[model samples]
Target chain A: MKTFGGPVLFLDRDDINTDEIIPARYLTEITKEDLKPYILEDLKLPGFDPKGETTKAARVIVTRANFGCGSSREHAPWVFEVNGITAVIAESFARIFRQNMFNCGMTAIELKKDVIDALFSYQDCPDTCITLDLVGQTLTVQGGGREESFAFEIAPFDKALVLAGGWVDYADKKY
Target chain B: MGKTTAEKIFASHLVDEPFPGAKVLRLDVVMCHEITTPIAIADLVARGKDRVFDPTKIKAVIDHVTPSKDSKTATQAKILRDWARRQGVRDFFDVGANGVCHALFPEKGFIRPGYTIIMGDSHTCTHGAFGAFAAGVGTTDLEVGILKGVCAFREPKTIRINLNGTLPRGVYAKDVILYVIGQLGVNGATDRVLEFRGPVVDAMSMESRMTLTNMAIEAGGTSGICMPDQVTVDYLWPFIKDQFASKEAAVAEFRSWWSDDDASYDKVYDFDLSELEPLVTFGYKPDQVKTVTEMAGTPVDQVYLGSCTNGRLEDLRVAASMLKGRTLAPTVRGILSPATPKVFQDALKEGLIDVFMEAGFCVTNPTCGACLGMSTGVLAEGEVCAATTNRNFQGRMGKGGMVHLLSPASSIAAAIEGKIADPRKYLPE
Candidate 1:
């Protein structure tokens, strides 16, 4: 699931809770695919229409601190996965949200505050390309004759699961 | 070596090296609710694994989205019910009989000291109040536990929060915990286990301890535990004594789970409970707490006093006492829900229900109710409320409905005044 480069959908808000990720009204649907279209609907974020050109074309979601801060609903990460968002880079994540991301086999990386701010600055330039290298523990932003790399870390178990295409695949092999 | 309460419980479940790191640990109880169980069952069925590893250890409760708000949620509840029956899971609780899973699990004697527990809801940390090492896992992990009888953990470090001194009047578990969360930011204790020790914890009642542990997850802690002592046994005895050979045996078993005196901790914090006042959270995050006195008279449209947190019998009693003979403001609407059916029955028997009803409070049957913003007393857009529930995030109470989390006493005060008011005036000095 490693993508070489993609457009970044910058959600620059801090403390983006699960309630905002996918509201409780949308949680009754058991399937991830059905729940994807409603992601961030509660927050009323700009340009969040799931079927719209921008949200569909954006492969990466960059945000500030405490992304997915409330509730343990896996639907928050499932929305990103089912909607074709492969990577989510934030300043930090709530533990359960990060765990949910790994469980769904999506890459959730945490960069420093400065690195996240740098990424958020590119929101105006939608054409900017950010490449995530899971194996190399680095995120590269390349565009307009500028390329910068930021290093990050993931727990050994999460790394293995994400590399193995999520928890189900890992369980299929390990269990 | 001295082990923290969490390390002690985790080691008890370890089949190999005792240190904290990635390893499969045995689980004594695995819990699920309507919102999370359907996905877990679907995943298991997709893998062609219909049988649960241990039917007896699994608990399925239909608490969230109960009363069939919509056909979709109703179908999900039906799926959980049918799956639990087919799997021979004996602990399933259908709508009327079930309350919040966090309360019902421990109330039904599923959680024991020194045990490792996992549930699909984040507030599963509430079970850690019994000195059990419990944490909330996502649906996938719950599925893994159902199939494997074990769940993986990365062995959490311990933070010892030493709360001492007797609490001031009108300041209780909710206030102390909210104050702690305020001091320690929302992510302060992320991935760490919190060991609540010191004199204040020992003096607190079982219900109060549960409130403390229940919100520990709000601070991002993996688990919050208190040492099992006489207070623990006394509270759990009535419900769990029959399971053991004798009362002495049950007490002895739980007593053995205490942490060593010299136990080394990764970090420690000291707090004097007397310094706390009634706390109310103003912003979206729980950590944005302020003293009730500071935010009193802040206007509100609704007041909710129920959830896994602060929804027990004691919590109702506190609210009832404050609301007795006093009617809510014409502008304010109050909704009260007990944490469990037993709590509702006890409140009814004690006439606490009359006290609330007489004051124009809408008392409902036990369910998660409006805590998750699913059903029963949903707030309209742009409405503000003072609530006793845990989280105050956007859309937590309803779409565009703002919630300020407070203790039960403060919640009643807010209702009576039609705004956030200091609850200390209602309590004895």
Candidate 2:
């Protein structure tokens, strides 16, 4: 399984819908490359810009409840992946949005609401990092010489797919 | 233990006894539209599956960006058309050929109870109004359906929403759902299915039930289902043919699909609709709903009446009845779109189209247009619209614009007054 870690960029907001992730106005663009630049531009979401230094520096996004709500556009996850966000830790996710993240080979770690609240308390802490170990099914948050590990859940099928680099690869091998 | 409606349907489709996590299970129907099908077709070809397992079981429709709003979307639609034709898909609805997939498929008698339906659009839960198990999936999941006639699913717990008491005048299924979503919050039903039960649900018409189920995703529900009843049989029988020639015969065969009396549920919510009023949403999230009386006189620049939600015949009738022999306020621009071609035709035949036209409302063909800011009637800067479509998120309808979601009556009343107003005043006594 793939293992990765990166500095955390926390968005304490709840119900960050797909429309704000990648607004439908940009969906008409044919390619994900073309749509990438417009990701979350409309919302002006904190720390989410393809060129912003803070967004470029962070690899994980932490948000409270309903990280990917609203429309089931695959482009939402594609944009996040394009912007170098490999993992999103949230209190919960709308099912279709979570499935799209899995399809895009990104990790969506769901921690309890209070756990997310605890993570948000470190929002202004510089150089905070979160590490994800897929095989271990855990996310480790570290800042100021303190580290905490939070357990997460992923079905066996999803684990295999992520290990195989998403469903296209998984299906190619299985079939 | 007795199974909930979601469990009952999933259990029937399992090749073996079900467990908790993902498993490849049978699919009765797989549907997609222009926006999602291109990705699925590309992924299918990349996986060495040049054709589908069962083209007859798949339905492709071009409804989201219909009539080719631009060269970009037009190219995407062309790609879907070519791929669907090459695969010999039996139920492909090209641009202008039908309306939205969610409304068109079921209206044409494709959806039925005790079956599992999968689609690439989040609103696919709209079909669950027929007592079917339908859930939205991503494009990769759609690829699974095309290549293998099955998709993986992890069973979800069921939440029972027991709606009781009679609906008050001017209150509709839209109001009921809006109220439910407001109480539940957007994440209340996350990772779960919602089974709507009790007398209020049973009394709803088929179209009203569809409206109820269509917004299930707004509250993060995997799907929402109401048990099949006489209303379901009556609305679907004319467009369908089976051994059942009469309503009694159809009900006898389909009624067994309902959840058992002793069914277990993970959570239960009780709502009384007796005092419900016309509802409207003030902010971005659908859960930001309130009674129209509380929000009356809120100013608006435009009004849109359509979507998979609130674009059915019943919704149109409500709007038309209110706008008949009246003109929209000169400052307001309104667009009234039916959900399906059949609905548009029926509205036209019933003179509802003329009523809207006389009120200076732009009556357009069925599409998900403008609801997602895709095409037609897009909002301009700093403008606000009272719309009947689902979702009022910032810029959902256009850039720098606001969307306030309301029932058709509320939207129509807003258009007539150029501001949000109580719809009850316009309802006939």
Candidate 3:
């Protein structure tokens, strides 16, 4: 099984769309690697900077509801994957975007609105970290000398895709 | 147990039940466009599995950035062109004949009731207007559909939205759907299909119904569907005539895809349209909707009247009617693009193109250009646009630009006034 644990970046907003995740202008590039520097370049969040230190150091994203709405481009998730941000924790996600994350061997974890609010409490904690344990189906967040663990669920097929290192490998075995 | 329309289609096309509520289904059509398909093709080629499951069932288009904006976009088109030719995909639409994929595909009669379609583009839900189950997917699912003709999904639950009462004059399908999205909020329909029903939808033309469904993604819906009826049969009659004895026969065949009367729904909403007014989006999110009166007089730098949502002949006619005998405000730049070659030709034949040009509008070929800010009509920093496209997300038309989503009639009014204005004031009294 696969798991992820790393530094976290928090964006407190809803309906963060695909265009904001990876702007439409750069979609012409042929490779996933070409999409790295432009991830979240168009996002207009108050304190977030695409080129800042917080972005480069973060390995996960915690945001509010409907984290990836609008266009169904997979480049949004590919950008996250390339930047080493393999997990996005949100109240909910746009359906296609959630699936694309799993297809890339990345995780999109959904917690309740209240749980998401609690997670935001650690946003200002510079040392905050998130550890996603797929084997135990749990998410643990620790920072500011406080820690909490929450149970999470992933569809069996999505878990299988992640364990198999994404859809390409899973399909290679099945087909 | 009664079944929703989506559930019925899923049951018929099911190849396997992966888990309790997840289904593996056989797809009827796999649509591809240059921007997203090139990566899938490259991956398949690298794996030595560059083969399409069924060439006849695939429809390819080079649309997003046609006439290649840059060397990179040119390379993207070449990959799709070579792959389609190698696979013998006859339905491919290249630059001269190409339009926006969502608009062009349906114009060619590629979609039908009960069919299941998948495309890498989010507006693939627009095809669901024909009572089909169509969803936008990602590269992995597109690759699987191309290679194996199969895709997996969680079995769908549906939300039935009943559009009741007659629409007041000057109100259009775009307004009604915007109202619905405003009420539901962006995430209200997440992971669910929206079945649009009742007399209002029944009265809408196929083109109008398509406009309603095309924005399904704006509300995070899997698809937005209307039960196939006589309007659908009449719209498709020319292409389907040889397959059926009569239009009624075709209609009868399609009626089987309708939801059962007792069908269970996750939720139901009844919207009264008698009080409806033209609507527009004021913020980056599509759900941030307000009445045209509430948004009037907001200065705009551009007015774009096209995209799959509002680039059809009906949209052009409505916009032309408003622009007749009126020129755009000197401060506003107006651009119009018909959705397909047919729409463009028909608009020309009907003098709609002349009306727009005479009104100081620049007409371009059918590309999904400015809708996604790829080439034509791109907005500069801090500029604002009144557009008839689906989404109004931040920087959708260009970096640091703001977009206001509205109907074609409203868009033309904004062009003439150089600000957001209600189209009803210009309507024939």
**Which stretches in model 1 have alpha-carbon errors above 4 Å?**
A1-5, A44-52, B15-20, B239-249
RMSD to truth, every model: 2.1, 2.0, 1.1
Per-residue error (Å), model 2, residue A26? 1.7
lDDT string for model 2 (B305-325, tens) is 999998889999988888888
lDDT of 1 by residue, B34-136 (tens): 8988998998898788778899999889998777778998999998999999999999999779888887777887877888888888888888888999988
True contacts kept of each: 0.64, 0.62, 0.76
In model 3, the runs with Cα more than 4 Å from the true position are: A1-3
Candidates 2 and 3 compared: the better one by DockQ is 3
How close to the true structure is residue B316 of candidate 3, measured as C-alpha lDDT? Answer: 97
Predicted complex 1: CAPRI docking category: medium
lDDT of 3 by residue, A1-175 (tens): 3457799989999888999999999999899999999989988788899889889888989999898998889999999888889999999999999989988788999999988988899998999999998989999999999999989888898888788888777766665
DockQ of each: 0.59, 0.61, 0.78
Report chain A TM-scores, every model: 0.89, 0.89, 0.96
Q: How many residue pairs clash in model 3? A: 0
Better of 2 and 3 by TM-score: 3
In Å, residue B185's CA in model 2 sits off its true spot by: 0.9
Error of 2 at A139 (Å): 2.9
